[model samples]
Target chain A: MSQVEELKSELTEKLGSDIQIKTEFGDDVLEISKDKVFEATEHFKSTGRYDFLMDVCSVDRQEREKRFDVVYHFYSSKDNRRLRMKAQLGENEKIKSITPIWKGANWFEREAYDMMGIQFEGHPYLKRLLTHHEFVGHPLRKDYDSNRQQHCSKAADLHFEDDETYVPDPNKDLIPLNIGPSHPATHGTLRIMAQLDGETIHRSNVELGFLHRCFEKMAETHEYNQIIPYTDRLNYCSAPMNNVGFCKTVERMLGVEIPPKAQAIRIILCELSRVIDHIVCIGANAVDLGALTSFFYLFNMRERVYSLFEKLCGARLTVSMTRVGGMANNPPEGWFDDVLETVATLRKGVDEIDRMLTNNKIWIERTKGVGGISSEEAIAFGFTGPCLRATGVNLDLRKANPYYGYDQLDFDVPYGTSGDVYDRYLVRIEEMKQSLKIVEQVAKNVPGGDFSIRDKDIVLPEKKDVYGNIEGLMNHFMLVIKGLQPPVGDIYDATEAANGELGFYLVSDGSKRPYRLKVRPPCFAIYQSFTQLINGGLLSDVISILGSLNVIAGELDR
Target chain B: MSTVPTVTRDLHAESEDLLTTAAYTTRFDKLVAWGRKNSLWPLPYGTACCGIELMSVMGPKYDLARFGAEVVRFSPRQSDLLVVAGTITEKMAPVLVHIYEQMLEPKYVLSMGACASSGGFYRAYHVLQGIDKVIPVDVYVPGCPPTPEAVLDGVMLLQKMIESNQPRPWKDNWKGPTQ
Candidate 1:
């Protein structure tokens, strides 16, 4: 029997007849009650082998009888499939926190509580994740005004009491250091409060939301097409990846198929974006270790790729390259030539970085055996992409559940045994090489067809047709004035983003705009384990680990 | 004057010979401004995408070192030019303000990118409308994330502003630390 069928039967056996299982928009959903959700999730991790907890988010259906739907996405590497478990509750109702079952659910659950104000019963620290304490309302709720702004005049006074279980010895002397919301090595706006015992980190508390620009709340009001530019800022380093992920989800929901050429082109751009993302991560990590030359070398190559992107599109960093049905524009003539040239040059950069940092004693000493996590711990913390692979767990979404014809593309998934800072760096370097391979393969064999879907409902008409043809003009007006009117439904789709699995949960209300849109940003999962990963390590190793993880503040706080 | 003490007094006494010219008549403020304009120690207040563009400008391609504003200090205490590059959410607003306040006198705030200048398209609950709402801005480079060339232009404009002896109206903040 299939995993879904087996899950249904098994869940029925565990929770009695109180559970409901059905497939919606390509996802096998198991609807369980609040009282039994803890049990169901326990079964998911243990018996069902749904080892990876991809995302946990709450949906505020302002008009629905249940009012709120707490969603949990689980992926089992053993089964190589995803299952969505949801529990519907009232406005004031509290659901079971899965933190005890899956430790990675800590931040995801806190995010649910913060955004939608859905209380989790047993969550250890039920504080806000992506907003300050002074923020008045749950910003993701339908009633929350988009224009409402809350100013935090001072720093939040929050203390994470030792969970009522472990009281610290009052006599132990330790020093506290606040690293960033803006400091050099912290990269972006992530803040970690670390208590040090002579340079060794004793305890740490991560504070995010300093860069949260309300991406989810903004998407609810924006049209299907308008949300494209917003997604660009999600993972600004790999802007096209976010665009593709969002567009692919909407296209899948719209039930439209992009042309072969668009699919192939999407793959090329996304792979190129992945390459750039890895380059930035590795370069930044190397800089933390005082290897500055590799950063310069890698970034020079990054500029070449950015210039190529500028030639394809008009922008550099925030390239909103993809659209709902297909791409915004076709790859210009001789673009593949540019791609090939850049790819050829980028490989040398890869080699240069390899030569510089791969076997260097200082680099090895600084990174190896530092911030290492076992494969089991990594999985329990819901790690994905290269970070998960570095733990010796083979789970690349591109390989396991291929999208945009990733299955046809030939490339190997590189993995490391010790899941340390060094392994992450190595995995990222190898992934960049593999990405270059994919880029070369796809750029060589350019597919020929319409660059976008032929559907008039989603794709805009040609400029010539808009100018000359009456029907085309009207069609253009309708599309531009009133955006895509998708059928009323909700779907959860995830793509393997550079950091991990970037998932988007969308609910359409038969309007041009989405009723609700929740982004399951990848780093949001990996970065939550900061305290767990860096607790016993020295202060210096923290920067190394953070850089390797690349907890992009854009996605982390968004 | 008190900070410099006898250094400026002795320089004034020996102005003719010390400056390597005997007949030169230049105002002290102008000379100070000229010196400040060339070697602008910029503290990059980078928080988002525009920060990446800021890095690009500082990198080898469109090197910021060409204009002599390349000493990118992370500490506010050490910098004169505060290049606020990226979006400043309300949560990040206090931090931005704190960083701005932490900067010494004659510090210039160059609001970089559309988001930093005016919140770009992210006009939502959490985002601060523009950083100018919190800190005084000397230059505003506009783009979702401005191109490297545009960022370079903004820096050059600030240098020009410095050279022309524009009043540092934000200088009023130097009277006493707000905190």
Candidate 2:
């Protein structure tokens, strides 16, 4: 038997007849009783099979007898396989929290609780994750109104006590400092509440939801294709990746295959986006360290990438450039030339930055040996993408599960041994070089063919054809009036986003609009470990650590 | 003695003529307005994507320094103009209001993007519909995340407003335009 099948049979035998095996949207899904979930998860983890908790989310099906499905996604690095486990719950039923097995489930559970009103029984601090403290209703519930406003009278009332277990010592002279929600060092809308005892931080608590634009709530109301624009705002730094990720997820549900040219174009756009995201991450992180000169050198290259994106699509920052079966449009004339030129400029600029800051005494002193995490801790916390790789985990989804012909592309995954802030910096810099290499290869071998799928139902006909031919007109009318409808099933599609694994947990009910859409933001996972990382460090190191994580507020609070 | 008096009188008349020309050369209001317009220390309240565009405006290419607004201050007390760059969520609205109130008198606000101006496309519950609901905005730049050039244009428009409007003392009964 194949590894997945063996594992499935083993899990079924271990969990008994209560577990049922099924496949939906080309993913292996196991349905388990709610009570057996914790035991099964422990067995799976302790057996040295599945070590990574890729994502944990809950979907609400209001009309069903079992109203909620608490979905858990697991990946096994040893077998190079992924598994989905679901536990059903009725209206007020609570499931055990998996935080003990995987600490990364802390925030994801909180998010599920916050959005869908699903209660995780053993979650230590089960509070609202991405909504205002006084938010009235669960926004992601099927019956909740999207237009309902929940307002609080005063901002002071919005501050909730953080993890009430830790009481401050009255003997120690701890001074409270509020860092952000608007401060330049905190980047985007993140507020850090730190209690310091003479420049050394005694304890720090992170406050999020300041940039929550209700994206998931908005996604439910939008059509399958209409939701592309909303994905762009999820991780605005690498928007095309989110766009392509969403499109790929819906396409996976539809079981449609895109053409070769579209795949090549998708690779170019996603890699370019990776370069841009890294530039912003590294540049902004440097600025936080008082190395402002590197920011200019890097931002110039970022602008070039943005211009290339502009050339490819109309928008620069929010490039909703991908559609369901393919891209919005083919690359314009000489687009490859523009991409190559940008790649060359990016290489020169990155090298210049490398020389300027890589071995700089100040840079090393500030970043080295700070915010270091071991591989085991990283895995337990569910770190992915560059941050996980920086711990020498080698857990890149692009390599482990190749999609869109990523296996054919020539590139290297750079990792760090120490997992320090400096190592993350090195990893990102190296990754930028690798991304540029991918861009060069993809640009060289871009195939010449249809940019979108030939299926009339999936893609709208050309404007000229629609204007002239009756069949073309009919197809256009059908597509425009009623959007693409995928099969009735749920699928979890994840891509190696610049920050980490950005997964879309989509549930479609054979309708134009999705029944439920959940975004498993990588930054959300990374930010959960922030308090532990910065607990004993100096107050200034907080900025360095936060920057190194590259936590974009758009994704974190989405 | 009579001829000496006439020569002294002519000298006094010439001095008086120089004094009158100097008075006409620079009006007090115009001088104050020019100083305020030329040296606008903008407190960049950049919160989101528009914040990046605002940074681009300050970069070497756009060169905000050319307009004498190079000194982008973080402290509201030091700043004369408030450039609200990105979205203001419900949680952030009070902080924004406090910052606006902390700015020194003769202040101007340039709402830098769609979010800042009118909450743009994010008309959801969390996002504040428009910053104008909380604080007064002088100029509103219209773009989802307006280009750097558009932001520069907004800055120039604020300068024009400063130059045209008379800078009456705060003690005077002249109130600025209310939201």
Candidate 3:
């Protein structure tokens, strides 16, 4: 038997007949009773496989007897296998907190509580996460009104309950400092409340929801194609990746395969996006450390990438460039030439930045050995992407899972020994070069043909054909009126985004719009460990650490 | 005796001209307004994607420094213009208002991007429909995260408003939007 099958049978025997086992979208799913959740999860963790808790979220089925399905996704770096466990609960029913087993589940559980109103019984500080403390209703619930507005009388009334008295240690003379929610260095809309002993931080807590645009809530009302624009706003730095990941999920449910040319174009766009994402991460990190020159150098290259995206999709930052079963459009004439020119310019800029920052004594002193986490702690906290790789874990989804023919491309996954701020910087810098290489290769080997699937239901006919041919006109009218309908099932699709694994867990009820859509943002997992990473570090190091993580508020609060 | 009489006449005439020029004062006002318009130090209240575009405006290509408004002061007290960029959620609305109130007199507010101008595409619960709901805005630049050039244009519009001596809502008895 295969590793997944062997594990599946073993889990079925161990968890009793109450568990229901099924395979959908090539993933093993275990539907367990609510009471046995903690026991089964603990058993799964103790087996030394499934070491990483990839994601934890809840899907609301308002009409069902059990109104919520709390889903848990786990990955085994040892055997490169993925397992999903879901426990169903009725309204007002409580589930045991998984934070005790995986510390990273803390935020996920709080988010579930905040969005769905499902309570986690033993979760410490199970309060509002992505909404204001005064927000009345759980937003992701199907019955929740999309247009309801909740207003606060004053900013003073917006304090967490624990903010009144909680302290890391009552004995120590620690000064409380409020870092942001508006400060420039905190990036978007993140607030850090830190307790400090002298200049060193004792403990810190992050406050999110400042930029919460309610993307998930918005996704419910939008059709599959209409939701593509909303996905662009998530992880806006690498927008094409979000577009592709969401499209791939829906396409998988529909079981439509995109043409080869479309896939190749997608590879180019995604890699270009990865390069842009790393530019922002590294450039912003360097700028936080008082190295402004590198930011200018890298941003010039980013501007070039934006121009390329503009040529492709007519917009720069929020490029909603992908469609289900294919891309929005074919590449314009001489697109390959533009890609090569941009990559060449980017290489020159990267070389210049390398000469200036790499091995610089001051940069090393500020970054090396600071805010470090061990591999064991990183895995437990569910760190992925470059941050986990910096701790010497070779768990890249692009290589292991090989989605979208990434296995056909040639690249290297750079890793580091010490998971410090410096190591993350190095990993991102190397990753940028590798992405550039991928873009170059894809640009050369890009196939020629249709940029979308041939199916009439899935792809819109050409405007000329629609205008002339009666059959084409009929097909166009039907598509415009009734959208593409996927099969009634659930699937989870993940892409190797610049930050890490960007997964989209989609549930369809044989409708044009999705029944439920959940995004497992890489930054959401990384930000949960922020307090641990910054604890005991100097106040200034917090900026460096946050920059290294590259936590975009759009994704974090979505 | 003849030279002395001529000097006395010239002194009396020159004193009369000086007094009239000082009393009129339109030229002095215009000069002061011109200086204020050119040397506008903006405090960028950059909160989201529009903030990135604002940064690009300051970069070498667009070169906001060429317009003489490149001195971006983080502190409200030091700035004469407030460039509110990106969406303002309810949680952040009070902070924006507080920053606006802290600015020195003769300050201008440039609402850059659709979000800051009118909450763009994010017309949902958490988002404050428009930043104008909290503080008065002098110029509204319309774009979903407007391009750097658009932001620069907004800055220019603010400079023109300052020169024209447009009546600021804050300067009047205008209370902000009611909840």
Candidate 4:
């Protein structure tokens, strides 16, 4: 039986007549009544079809009749399918939590509680996950005004609760180690309170919002073309991929067919970015392993990649280059030649890095068996990318879904048998080589054309042409200021990011700005499984696992 | 211009007589020069992807070792140059300010990216817009990363700025501009 269908059938058998099952794009969706959600979740898990509670997040349905709908995304590792169980829980109502079934759902559920104001009943510890403990209101709700500066009552009092005078556990003597609002290793402004049992971590909780740029809200406020710049901040490592992800999501929502040349260019750029992301991961892992020399070696390779990025786009990091249809600017003269040269240079460096660490005794000893996780545990905790591949799960969305002519490209899906840190490292290295292969294929197969979809409705006419023609001028004006509007629809499109399945769920309400924009960031899924991976491991192993995961705070908290 | 006991020799003889000028004034000038030269351990505070490029600045090709800045300390106490190498968000502002405050006197900062210098195009409510608001910037190395060459230039510029100082006057004249 196919994974999707099997999950649906199993869900139907479990829920019986109480739930309404719907399949959206091969995902088995179960719309359980608000009252029966907890019961249904329990039954679904008992059925063994959806053993893992992948993620529990709530979406604000302010415009719709259903005020607030909570989405509980489930995955069956055995079947390799996903099942989403959503409930139309009324505004300000308490719903039963599924934290009992899966311990991993603790953080996800708490995040929903903290952000969406959805109270998860029966949660062991329902404290705010991302936002401060004294934060005034739910920030993620559509109606919530993010502009309000006085969200927290006081700097000391960062979170709030229904209890008038709430006091945390006094007996749990956990020394406060303020990781960062600016400290290194936390990456960005992420501060985690690690309740440690000496060197071992009893429990750790993340305190995000230090770098919360309100990107989604801004994207909603800005025009379509204006929002592309914002995507650059989400996955700062691979700005091109984020741009492509956003554009592709909007394109899917609008049902616009981009030119073959544009598609080909995007694939090439995205794959290059994937390679860069892996290089960073590998370099960072090497740094954590005390192999500081390898960092410089890999950076030498990255310098060449940056040159290509500069040649292709004006900016290096904030590459707001890829537009909705074509590109913001044309490639510089001999850009392809420069790209080919860069690849050649970087390829040699990659080989050297591989030689330095591939069989090195110290590197293997540090990473070989450290932070080993099984495929089942990984899937249960919703791990993806090289992290998932390390566990021998052949699930790269690029191959499975084949967006942007990915199916046409001849590349290998590199998987490692051992789900250890070493395997993850090996997978990322191999993935980089495969990315090179894809880049080479794309360079060879790149079609020549206008580089954009020649359409007045979708893509703005040239500035000169627009000035010459009245209609073109009007269209350009509209596109520049108000942005292009797509019909009302919702679509979820995922690409194989270096980290994992980087999915962007975009909803257009026949307006220039997206009505709803939810980034299914790969880092969040991988980072959630962090505590699980690091539970019994040594203190130093935390650094190892974090590096291996490549959990960028920018993408995670976004 | 009358023979006034030749003030230089008179002062020297008088000082020499008075316990040999009470020893040395810690050789203030040389001490300052030595302190400045030996301990330039920088806090390479990087955020976003530009941080990766910032890391490249300390790497082999453009080794920061020549300037005695190879030891990129993560802590503020031991660091001299705080290289803000990405967008500074409002959420990160206070922390940046705190880190700047924690560093000992005679410190420098390098806003090492378009985002860190001028907010790039990520001008949003959460982003501080620029690092200038949070800390006094010594050099603004402009690029998405300000290439290793640009970083070296900024470092050299900062060193020159530090070197051209006339001690007391430099200390007194240092108004510490907001930028």
Q: Which clashing pairs does model 1 show?
A: none
Encode model 4's per-residue lDDT on A1-558: one tens digit a residue: 865556556656765665566765445677778887877777766667566565667778887777787877765545456667778977768888877777667777877887778888999878765554445777667766655433232223222223324345547755434455566566655565554567876555556666566676677677887888778778877878999988887777666778888888888788889888888888988886789889888877776777788777756666777778777656767777777777777778878989999999999988999888888777767777889899998888788667778888899998998799999999888888888888887877668877887667778888787879898889888777766887775556667777887777666778887877777778787777776676646667777877888887778766
lDDT of model 2, residue A195: 83
User: What is the lDDT of every predicted structure here?
Assistant: 0.85, 0.83, 0.83, 0.73
Angstrom error of the Cα, residue B119, model 1: value is 1.4
| CAPRI band for model 3 | acceptable
DockQ of each: 0.58, 0.36, 0.43, 0.28
Please write out the lDDT profile of model 2 over residues A300-330, one tens digit for every residue: 8878887888888777788888888898887
Ranking by TM-score: 1, 3, 2, 4
TM-score, one value per model: 0.94, 0.93, 0.94, 0.85
Instruction: Find the 10 residues in a row with the least total lDDT in model 1 chain B.
Output: B1-10
Q: Who is ahead in DockQ, 1 or 4?
A: 1
Alpha-carbon shift of residue A396 in model 2 (angstroms) = 1.6
- Supply candidate 2's per-residue lDDT for B101: 78
- Highest DockQ model number: 1
Native interface contact recovery, model 4: 0.37
Which residues of candidate 1, in runs, are more than 4 Å off?
A1-3, A161-172, B1-25, B170-179
The residue-by-residue lDDT of candidate 3 on A1-558, one tens digit each, is 976567667867887665567888888888888888887889878887788898889999888999999999987877777788899999989999989988989999999999999899888789888777678989888888766768755553323335755644556657778777767688748888888889998777788888887788778788888899889878878889899999998888888888889898888989898888888888888888999888777778888988998898788888887888798788889999999988999888887877888899989999999889999998888889999999999889889888778899999999999999999989988988899999899898888888988678787787888999999999999987888788888888888888898999998898878888999999999998888889889999999999999998888887
Candidate 4 lDDT by residue in tens digits, B12-93: 4544464444333344555565457545788877777667677777877778888778888888999888888776665566
